[model samples]
Target: MMKLASLGLFVFDASTFPFSDLNRRRDWRYGAAPRIGDRDATQYLGPGDELVTLTGALVPEAGARYGSIKTLATMADQGEAYPFVDGSGVVWGSFIILSMDERRRALLVDGTPRMIDFTVELRRVA
Candidate 1:
């Protein structure tokens, strides 16, 4: 499993982003970022909005792949984008959620990729 260092998230109406393997040394490949339409752009996540969250451990290979997929899937999802890395090799994972009204946080340990469920939400910590 991998560790979580810091996370930065951006919410946009829409964005076009390229994809590349986080662990592999390669240039950006053609990809897209999820976007918010003009109408939805006005709806801001405020300090009162509830934030839903999920957490788990992930192997390095699968962790990077999950991260890449979340980055690559923005075109269709068009909601929020979050990317984080631990930089330390410890592989301990941590997660936090900033909602319209509150913040939630959790810690995780290294584990296999079988637990990952892409259909629900993509949680990746490198």
Candidate 2:
């Protein structure tokens, strides 16, 4: 929903709507061995990892929101990380941009991006 830029200089509001395929996957690592005549034995390791991925697009709100998404997409392309906060003010931690896609018809006649469809894979970094 919103992100605080570094140094608190400004905030980039990238509000997205019609969020699709939003999900979270949590996993753990373990060691398992099969027994000869029985089932199997498992050993617990430790905490594994978590990641959240989703596909969504920016609505045609106004200029500033659209402009900020362009900036974020550029930063995402360079493997930059940012705190992805939702409209509920929940901080999703540092997330690296895995992928971004834009529809060709999303651009306005003035050359500004009106709507952007993107799919991003966000890994949670403690």
Best candidate (score: lDDT): 2
Worst 10 residues of 1 by lDDT: 12-21
lDDT of 2 at 126: 55
lDDT per residue for candidate 1 within 1-126, as digits (tens), equals 222333343221112111111221112233344566633223433332222232332233333333433543542254444453333633323223332111212324543343232212233322
How accurate locally is residue 72 in candidate 2, as Cα lDDT from 0 to 100? 51
User: Which residue pairs overlap in candidate 2's backbone?
Assistant: none
Q: TM-score for all predictions?
A: 0.18, 0.61
Residues 19-123 of candidate 2 have per-residue lDDT tens digits of 446677878889899999997899999757777666666666643344545665667667656676654666666667665555534667887766666665666
Weakest ten-residue segment in model 2 by summed lDDT? 4-13
True-vs-predicted CA distance for residue 83, candidate 1, Å: 21
Give the runs in model 1 whose Cα sits over 4 Å from its true position.
1-48, 61-64, 67-69, 72-77, 80-126
lDDT of each: 0.30, 0.59
lDDT for 24 in candidate 1 is 15
